[model samples]
Every structure is written in structure tokens, then in C-alpha cells.
Target: MKVLSMILAGFVVGYAVSDIRPFDSLLSSTAEFGSPTTIVNGLTVLALTACLVSVALARSSARGVLVVAIGAVLVVVFRTVGMVTGMFGDWAGAVGAGALLGASAVLAGRHRAAQASLAVAAIGAGLLGTALDALLQADDGPVFVWDVAGAEDAVVPERAIVMVIAALGTALSLYQAHRDVALQSHETRRTLLVGLPLPIAAGVVSWFAGGHDSGDAVWLGALAGMAVLAVVAAFALPGRDGRVLLVLFASATIGSMGFAVEDSLQLAVSVALLVVGAGIGYRWPQLYVGLGGLLVVAGASLIEGYVALPSLSQFALPFVVAYALVSVLSTAPGSLAVALPALFTMSLPVTVFAASYQAGLSLSSDNAVATRTSEPDHLVLSLAGLVVVAVVTVACAVLMRRPTQNPAAR
Candidate 1:
């Protein structure tokens, strides 16, 4: 029952965070300054910041629940009035929804050991939500056609359904929090301040790269900058948390390469593979194996770019990404400070890929086609990011293996 509640909480938060419909609606209804890509970038930063603040401030389980509940309420309000209020309400609601997600994870997994499972569940649920949203928005029959421009208008019934899920999840999480012994939040202001800027800056860089004026040089520079920052941040942080961040960076990079999946069935299959990989990682939790999987994903992507393989082979990408992420998280000391920031950082790569590849806006094809061929430049860019991630993953692994110095011995 406890696990179920956590899953529910994760699903709600995941759905709220991943669903781009509200933002899409906001952009369409009002004259937003930037393109869809820029808005997404800003929203990602806001969500990351909100997650950090909510987790840092929620000193107890009760506070965590309260924060999450408030976040849920804000999302519900956004869904209700987003069309009416234009941009500000939608943006504010997204931030609140992000806070709810961050707080709920902390509340559910109060101990270090449980944080990995909570993260896995939450991520899987979020991916599921993304797939479901696509299916729900399909214009003809059950088949969902991918549109890079943006999803069709906000589906009213779907919005209501998501709100209900968020409410129920919040209630369940509250009940579970009340039953369990309250765990004090371990996050500190110093750590929050130190860790906050990297992901936000990464998002900003990605947003800039995604802009119409930016070219391949800007995108490559952003990728290189993010890689350096992630590696430096990983080593700068003490113990396993840094390694966790590196692995998540790799996961995000690999996962973002899947932008070519054009239909709902392929997406559902990819998400299913993600769940399987998460389960495997939870059971084994091997860092090296996960690292190797990252390499395999990189290799496979390069191969697919040049060689014509069976289209179904693409599903392996998400599996490897999820496995790598969960494996590293399982080994780390569960801290929302690390987990939430790392998770948000994961979004930067996706933003970059979307902007660089001109996803949604450029990729328009017949619904009957299951997948589209990725451009050569996009493949090369993905390979470059993945190679950097692999290098960082190895460096992190080596650093993690080193013995800590004993003060008395020194």
C-alpha cells in the first residue's frame, strides 16, 4: 500500500511536469515573445528552481505534504483558468506543479535507501504520462501522430482526468505521510545555493541554442558547456551524489536522441522498455554495466544513422537510458537535493535536442509511418553529446572507486 501510494504520487507529479499541453495552450492563446522552444526552456528552469526551493524548505514530512498539496492546487487552477489568464498563470502553475513533484518525492522516500525506488517509479510514471497524453490527443482513431510544432489544443477531458489524479495522489501521499514517522529533510541552504545554478544555466544555454538565430556552432557549444559543467559538478560534490548526477546526464542525453519516434505505438513500446530497464537496474544496480549500456546506445545510434536496421530496434534506447539512471540512483544516498537537481538537469539535453533538431516544428509526416529518418547532422550532434557523457561517466566511476583518506592515517 505504501509503495502504491508513492507510485500514485509519482504518476501525478510526473504527469503534471511532463505534459506540455498547458504551456502549449498558453502560447497559442496569447502572443508569447519566444518560440515554443524558448518557453519550454524558461519553464524547465522555473520547474527546477521551484523543485529546489520546495525541497529545501520542507523540513518535515508534514511540510512536504503541504507543499505538494499546494502545488497540486496550483496545477488544477492553471488547468481551469490557463486559457483565460494567458501566459503568467500557466507559467506560475508549471512552477507550482514542479514544486509538487519535487516535494512529493522527498515525502515518499524519506530515507536514503528508498529514494532510488521512488525516483524510478516517478520517472517511469512520468514517461507513461507523456505517452498517454500523446495517445489522448490523437486526431484520428487510436493512433497518435507525432507533431513537432506542438500537440493539438488542450484536451478538456484529459485535463480534468489529470487534475483528479493529482488530487487523489496528493491525498494518498498525505495519508501515507501521516501514518509513517516523520523524517526531517536533510537539505541545507548552502547545498541548495551551490547546486542550483548549474542546471538552470544549462537550461538557459540549451534554450539559447534552440533559438532560431542559433546555429550548429551555438548548439555544439552549449553541449560542450553542459558536458564540462556536469563533469565538474559531479567531481565537486562529495561521494556518490556526483556519480548519480553524471549517470543522469548520460541518461538524459541518450533519451533525448529518441525524438524521431513518430507514432504512439512506438512511444508506448519505448516507454515499456524504459520500465523493464528500470526494473533490471533496481535489481542489479551495477554502475559499470549501466555505463556500458550508455556506450551501446551511442554505438547503436551511430549504426542506425548509417545502416538501415529494423525500425523496432529503436526501442532499446529508452531501456538503456532508464537502466543507467536507476542503477546510479540506487547506489547513491537518497537526497532530494541531489535527485531533484539531477532530474531537472536531465531536461537540458532534451531541450537542446528539440531545438537543434527542430523537433515538432520540422518533423511532419504521414501517420502511417512508424518512425522518421533522422538527419545526419542531428545524429552527429547526438553522438558528440553521448561520447562526452561516456567520458564523464568513466571519470565519475574512477573517482567513486578511490578510497577516502583517513584523517588519522594522513
Candidate 2:
């Protein structure tokens, strides 16, 4: 399970690097430094993968062949990342590389970590990659198009702070997961490997959405219906049920992929939603809290349709949906207040800081960026939404304070 997770992280980092530096050559195609971002990220993934494979090799000889094969595969992935261009070629390359990684991980079998170090490797590298990307971002503040040049700013501190919190948060979650698995809880699966297909499909779908018209009513209806099914799957199925998770991921991925696909402004926001869903599954504690978190989202969406809330704020909807699955079936109501910070941070706070830092650094502090996200209404509605969220969270917390209010906990 842990090995697969690590491999998944490595694969994602590889993909991110490819996206970050799609072109092989720099300006005029004469620069000696060819896609510095891609080269660096590729090296990072290679180093991590090699480290993981080395550990596995130390435990057994059978892994040696697997190690060689994986090394060869990584070489191929790195070489082709820039060699390939355009939508079709990129899609094929990504899918092919991901499949190779998946096959290698599966063939290698699971490794026993002396101290749950495997999960830490997977979780840590994944977290660090995002932080590095955020920290290294240029082009004003936290605007999402992170091309590989920028002087650090105030956002750096906030990202660093979040990185610390993420590390501790993941550690706690892993510990609880270990306990659950030790107790033979059904919620703990052998691996989330079965769930990997959703992201691959999502990446492709998101890319497809990015280039085309998704404004047609048919696409909207299809996506909305998928989302409804995804919510239904959350309520009707078990926590670790593969089929249900597949539905949930597909819905969350494609639904958000399609919803924000039409608007160029929503591209970053859409990517953010997909990342949250992919990175953080419906893990413990999050299983029920999603319901309360989503209540705020649904309300906000309705209001946004009329009042024109910033599109970045709309990104929060999927995170809440992913976090706040319909729990009435498996668990009772949960405290919304508990999930408020997480929901907010993962969604709006991220958007705000991205916009804020951009506004503060690149654009005039007095004048907003030309982006729709920079509109004045973003601040006003966002804070009002947060206040409303806080009030709702408190009410739910008070109500769910009783054990009967949260059957899932029992």
C-alpha cells in the first residue's frame, strides 16, 4: 500500500514537472538551459524513486530486476517529458508513463516499513513538491501560472507555515490509519491503488475541458448528474469500497473539470479542486465532516449565481463535496466547525492568498489585477461567507456535541 502511494507521488511529481515546463527549449530555442523546471522536477522524482527502490532492494533480491526496470522507465519518462508536445502526444506520454509506474509498483509487492516510513516518504514528497512549486512561483503573487522565475515574497511565509501544518496533519492521519489497520478495520484498505485510474482520467478530461467549449447545457447536465451520483455513492457505499471511491473520484474530478472548464479564469481553480480530491481521499474524520462543509458550498454556489462571487471561491465547492460526502447512510451528522478551517484553507484561503500576493506584489496594492479573481467582491463575499461558515459550524458543533448526533463516530 505504502509503496504504491510512493510511486503515485513520484508519478504525480513527474506529471507536474512536465506541465510546469512543457516546452523543451527556452526563448529562441537557443538557450542552453532547456526547461530548467522540468529538469529539476524530473531529478527530484528520480532521486525519490531511486531511494524508495533502493530500500526495497535492501530487503530482498527479487526487487533488483524491478529496480533496473523502474530506472529505465524513469529515464524514458524524463527524456520524453519535453520531447513530446501538443495535447495528444502529452496525453499518450503521461498515460504510458503512469501505467509503467503502476505496473512496476504492483509487480514489486508491498514493502514493510519499520516505522511507517513508507507513508511518510509518499506523503512528504507529495507535500514538498507542491510547496516547492508554490515557493518557486514567479509572475506576481500566487497567480496559478507558475513559470520558473520569481523573487520570493510574503506568500512564501504562508506556504511554509502550511507545509509545517501539512506534515503534522499527515503524520497524525497516518498514525490513526495504522491503528485502524492494526485493529482490522474494514476502512483500511490494502492500497488505494485501485483508485489510481480516476486521476489519469481526470488529467486527460481536464486537458480536454481546457481546450474546448464546455458551456453546452448537455455537458453541464452530464457533469452535474455525475456529481449527484458521486454524492450518492459516498452515502450508499462503504468508506474503502473501491467502486464507490471510483464513482466519487470520477464525479469530483470530471464534474469540477467540466464545470470550470469553459472559463480561462477558472483553470487554476479547477486544477486546485482536482489536486485536493486526488491528494486527499475520503480519509478518517473527513468522511462525515464533508456533509457540513458542503452545505456551506451549495449555499454559496446558489448565491454566487446571483451575486457574482469570485470564480476562485467556486473552487471550494469540490473540496467540500469531496470532504463532506453524504454521511447519513454510514455516519450521522458531523461538526461543520471542525472542518471549517480545512475546507476554507484548501479552497478559498488558497485562492485568496494566490490573488492577494499577486495583487500586492505584481500589481498596484491600490488597484486590483485585471483577473476576475481580483475583483473587490472577492474580499467582501469571501469574509461574509466565512462568517456565515463560522456560525453554521458552531451550530452544527453544538448539535453534534451529543454522541447521538454523530452515529458514524460510534
Best by TM-score: 1
lDDT of 1 by residue, 1-410 (tens): 54555556555555655654422433345533245444454346444654465445546556445655555555644553333234555665566556655555555544433555456655665555655656676785354333222222543555445556556665655565545556554434423544666655665665555554555566667767777777776665544556767877766666563433456767667667877887787788887888887777667777777788864335776677667776766322223444443554444432322322223544673233222122227475557756876787677767778554221100
Q: What is the lDDT of residue 377 in candidate 1?
A: 72
lDDT of 2 by residue, 1-410 (tens): 43343334333333333232322322233322222322222222322233233323323333343444344444333334333344333343334333333323323232222111222222223323443444345344454332222232212333333333433343333333332221101111112221222222222322222222332333333333433332333333223322223222332331221233333344455446534643454234343355445445545554665785675435665455433332221221011111111111111111111222243554546544432211223334333344434433443344344443211221
For model 1 the TM-score comes to 0.75
Relative to the true structure, how large is the alpha-carbon lDDT of every model? 0.56, 0.32
| Global CA lDDT computed for model 2 | 0.32
Best by lDDT: 1
Lowest summed lDDT across 10 adjacent residues in model 1 is found at: 367-376
Worst 10 residues of 2 by lDDT: 332-341
* Candidate 1, superposed: residue stretches over 4 Å from native: 21-42, 61-67, 70-85, 110-114, 125-130, 139-155, 259-267, 330-376, 402-410
> What is the lDDT for 112 in model 1?
33
Question: Any residue pairs clashing in model 1, and if so which?
Answer: 148-360, 148-361, 149-360, 149-361
User: Where does candidate 2 clash, by residue pair?
Assistant: 141-357, 141-358, 290-323, 290-324, 291-324
